[model samples]
Target: MTNRVEYLRSPTAIRERCNELFELAQADQLPYFRVDLTQLDAVADYVIAVIREHYPDLDVPFHSRWRHFEVGNIPRVRQLEQAIESRSKIEQAKAKFDLVIPSVLLDAGAGDCWKYHEATTQKTWARSEGLAIASFDAFCQGAFSKHPYQADATALKQITPEQIGAFFQVGSENPLVGLEGRSALLQKLGQTIEQSPDLFGDVPRPGNLVNYLIGHADQGQLSAVVVLNAVLIGLGEIWSGRLSIEGVNLGDVWKHSSLSGDQLIPFHKLSQWLTYSLLEPLQDLGLKIIDLDQMTGLPEYRNGGLCLDLGLLQLKDPKLAEIPHAADSELIVEWRALTVCLLDRIAATIRKKLGLTPESLPLVKVLQGGTWTAGRKIAAALRPGGTPPIQISSDGTVF
Candidate 1:
């Protein structure tokens, strides 16, 4: 019974299968894309420069949702703590979990034209940072709450499109990309948490996961993979119309032509992202999460776009850039999978050059000091609006 289904459950599964496809593409056996190892060193050089430029002493934090909360140099999370000073540390951490889960889920493409002005910070924000600030503001305003008092898990379980859209300023004149899809995903996430009282608890708060992790933690330690697995399993029902096997909803896992037995390549990009985001919160709870690199590099737009923009991943058809593609298309999946594989290779070179161990400069740091920034920088130089090299019709959940 614990056969292929188990393989589809972990972040490691995503790494293994993506590695396989990467190798096949290297041998020119896979269609839709080709791997260019020659440009990898150049890619490495650019990322290293970006890393050194920002973090001169190389004190890079793990890339996560926490970074976005501080947009415009505002310590939004710290502010949240100050506002909720009466709560216990555990309660605060749980509140953070509640905010982070939906905030991360709400993070998709905001499109080019839309922008957010943080009224408190007095700074204009756009894209991910804008979304993060807006979500944080909404959380503070009790958008996720059923009562007017405070943010709660059960409240998050009953979120709506109007709440999401109004906070993010979505309207006919100011439209957001994937607005409906984004709203539906968060609404479903609420439902999933409500049903999973065992994991999420009776009130089913997202922060209840912090308590679950604390219980499963061995000698005050928890596995990073377990956190991701919990997110994938607890919220599996959130992602609709994706691949499923044996009656289990494989959240973010997809099919590919690379294998037949279980071509299900799991790229729990957002889940892994949430796992990274929870690092500091769990640390605040006095729990240590080990095996950071086991989660793998995210295979989303920025990292994947770095590969395409750098010429490390060449489209088989040059004209394909002009077309709108579904997120699950063969070409897009291949690109996402390859981005996962290549980020590992690139991280190795970055660590080697910096004379740092994986513990010091994990893939998470490399991504933060790392590839995603480099990709966006390059995309800005190569294309107008700094759009990704390939267009993906992302539902709010996946990206």
Candidate 2:
């Protein structure tokens, strides 16, 4: 039982399980969506066009939460770097982890209405950008720690929904979805860090993960999967009301009826996102990050939405789009599983078009220059406020 649970938490499991559903989708055995390979070429072309528009020279960064910090071309991460420039290299890495870990956890759907007004820049930002800026501002003000730049467990365990709401400037008119869930996640994160002394260290800080990963590095080189494993093991318990096996909480893994036995499918979307976000800091510390493609594409709305908007995936029941679906529902789970498979296909097609290999143009880069932005563009053109084709009821956790 424990071994099966461990397998479910692995990247191989994510690919294999999602591929199983994709095969079912291809055979027209799935209940909700149809696979449209004919439209894949058009989808690939659209994503390539978006890539060209964003990066004409074809250089693209990894798709991570860090990109949100650069919203409005504001150089927010640069500002943080400058502030912590005097710290030692290890401390700097820790600070980066401190900021991005919570930021990514807070980065579920912000709904269509919520917006953040940056007092420094006098700019109004919405959605992910807004959430990033809000969390950034809160961190800058020491919302997560006594010091203005660290996230210590003592502070995080005591965080409240009202405090998060205040930090985000949430009010009746400017409501953010899943306020309590977001707060609870952070509180749990604090507890997880405090309890996992081997990973977080005795100091009980999120930044201590830097030390843990550094220790795990083999000759200053690490696989992306190692980082992902640390993330899942260190922070898995932060997830609320998730499936568990032998007392192991399966964060972001879900269920689908098409599969036999447990019918479980894993899509550790946010954990993988956190892993991607952590890579830059590891790289900055001069650690070589290898096996980059081992980590699968994030199975989120943007990437999944790209598939739906471009007709790569068509819903058998078109009415499914009009109603809000729970994140754990079979329809949503299957949609996300199909998304994981399609992103690989899209990445391959994009690489072929650009005459590049997976090494030069990895799935993460494809997501950045490629699919996610294309999805948003298509969504904006197809609907009001650039909403996803399928509406999901968010709980400030899973998308």
Candidate 3:
């Protein structure tokens, strides 16, 4: 018999489990918290205001890690384009795939204090943008490449902790959260790539994923969820100590008691975030990735914090927000699962208020417009450190 945990291995499982939890919450069956669906309108208003302010014409882009790189009006991608101008468009796509896969993997929470100084911009970036730039610079310097002279994919298949640690500035005074785990994760990434010759080729370049998508595309069409599944299957082993069932590693899937059957709930937040990031690159190759809404909202702290900050979700004890919780704690599991359901509700309200259809105002744009930003805004307003309402212990692998 197939292992039950295997169901939680896909994007479908994440959505289904989240929806099941939402229905339970709606019926007041969840014990950790109570959700007031009526309160979502206020949250919607706040997000709508933010969206209009940032995107005046409502022309919002998909929410992805790429946006962090374009911070401060920096043409980061254009700079990359100029650097790789010698390669054909297809090869450029591969190079970008190579660059982005590892970059996105390295993008866990950087805590509040650590900052990156961009020598070129002469500015300091504190959070995600800093990490993105730092990772990009490392990639440009060929940090992921082993030979630095090889023409093929094997170059990226030789990353090491020594190289990644120094490049990320993981040291005593400048501590990065989960530095050890993060370093180990990258080294394992190189190993994972090298082992998958059919998918990654002899050298195991991240860009080779572009070829897989292109070749498997159904009549020039692909689903965003399909991209997410590819990421989960390709890099599942890179995440150390994640859930595995029947010898298959279930990356980013967790267990929650509120739901039954497999007893495993999936939330591949980072992988889905990676899928969202891949949209532009694949589109650059002239492939249309349809069914954007099929991908659920990311269940990270920023989005979950927004619910608590906005009073949409209320903890039973109220003091739970201040306590440190493990990544797998039932409290956080509920919070994260609830965030997924609430995001869909929030998007529905915003779309109705804006007089737009899901076709026009997809959840991607809704997120970019202001849901995540509003979460950050509210956090900074309510908390001193701008941390999430509930603290999570990150292993540099899971957020």
Candidate 4:
């Protein structure tokens, strides 16, 4: 058996293999994408099995339904519903969360090249090499201070101290995948921005989110895959910006690249969707938003709809709810890799269904229309089924 395990940790290897898979997918080779679906399904089944095996008593947080809970004697979800009932507030929160939180989660040292409102804060913090958690925490603190929080002591007291402090933990702050928590904090920050635009600015600057992702990925002279997920998922580009990579401009390079001259996939549409998902709270705060159709989705999900339903991605086993599951070496690698492979499966399905040639196919398009949409759909689907699996953890970062 070729050990498929190593691919998750290695960026260079991942990019390389992804290219290889892309080629295979272009040829409509089913084995390239579907070979491991059964295995992945088994893996997911096994994870649940393992949880049941080891901790039969563990209650997984897979509350995929809706229920009301009070926090600070106020209903958080209800507050959100009330806010977005208005039209203008909806626009503001969306743009702000989309543009702001992604940049806020990057390491303090790297987001500097991009000229943002508080780029100086990023430049000043200067994260230590390989210190993602600490760096992320510092970024959150700065961003939070800049967010719309109550200036008055009464409101401050009403706020959960744990929630407030959770915003500053630099390393993985998410309740689930613990590997350098990224998404949850961004999500939280987005919600905060949505709820309190009076404090945080509306509208994430064009490309600021992307710049932060790229720059943070390159920091310490090494790329972190977890960080990459944070960047791509939270702040991907709606349109490819003209930029130099390895002495070649992206626009020119893209032409010669496999996806060039292909029907524009509107990959940014998926990205825009995800950006919208992340930024909806910000939208509630009275900021203007860019058009949702502007961004593309990540290759992780292709052909739209629910990613969880399509079996491409699965949430962390709710049974391991409190264990900081992302830090589990075996589990994290298995889940992320499974997700990646499934995403490719979605692309392969699209290629075959659409009759598009590989070189000219809108790979980014499929990602936006297909898989990314699925992930968001699944996320939305989970809202009404049970108590959503999202746990309020005390990590300074939000997913």
Model 4: number of backbone collisions? 61
Candidate 2, residues 10-43: lDDT per residue as tens digits?
A: 9999999999999999999999999999998899
In model 1, the runs with Cα more than 4 Å from the true position are: 147-154
**TM per candidate:** 0.96, 0.99, 0.95, 0.31
Q: What's the best-to-worst order under TM-score?
A: 2, 1, 3, 4
* lDDT on C-alpha atoms for all candidate structures: 0.84, 0.93, 0.81, 0.32
lDDT digits (tens) for residues 96-193 of candidate 1: 88888888988888888888878886787889988888888887788878643255555665666776788888788777888878878877777888
Q: How far is each candidate from the true structure, as Cα RMSD in Å?
A: 1.5, 0.8, 2.0, 16.7
Backbone clashes, each candidate = 2, 0, 2, 61
Better-scoring candidate (lDDT), 3 or 4: 3
**Superposition-based RMSD of candidate 4 using all C-alpha atoms, in angstroms:** 16.7
Measure candidate 2: CA RMSD. 0.8
Off by over 4 Å in 2: none
Candidate of highest lDDT = 2
**Model 2, CA-based lDDT:** 0.93
Let me know the TM-score candidate 3 reaches against the reference structure.
0.95
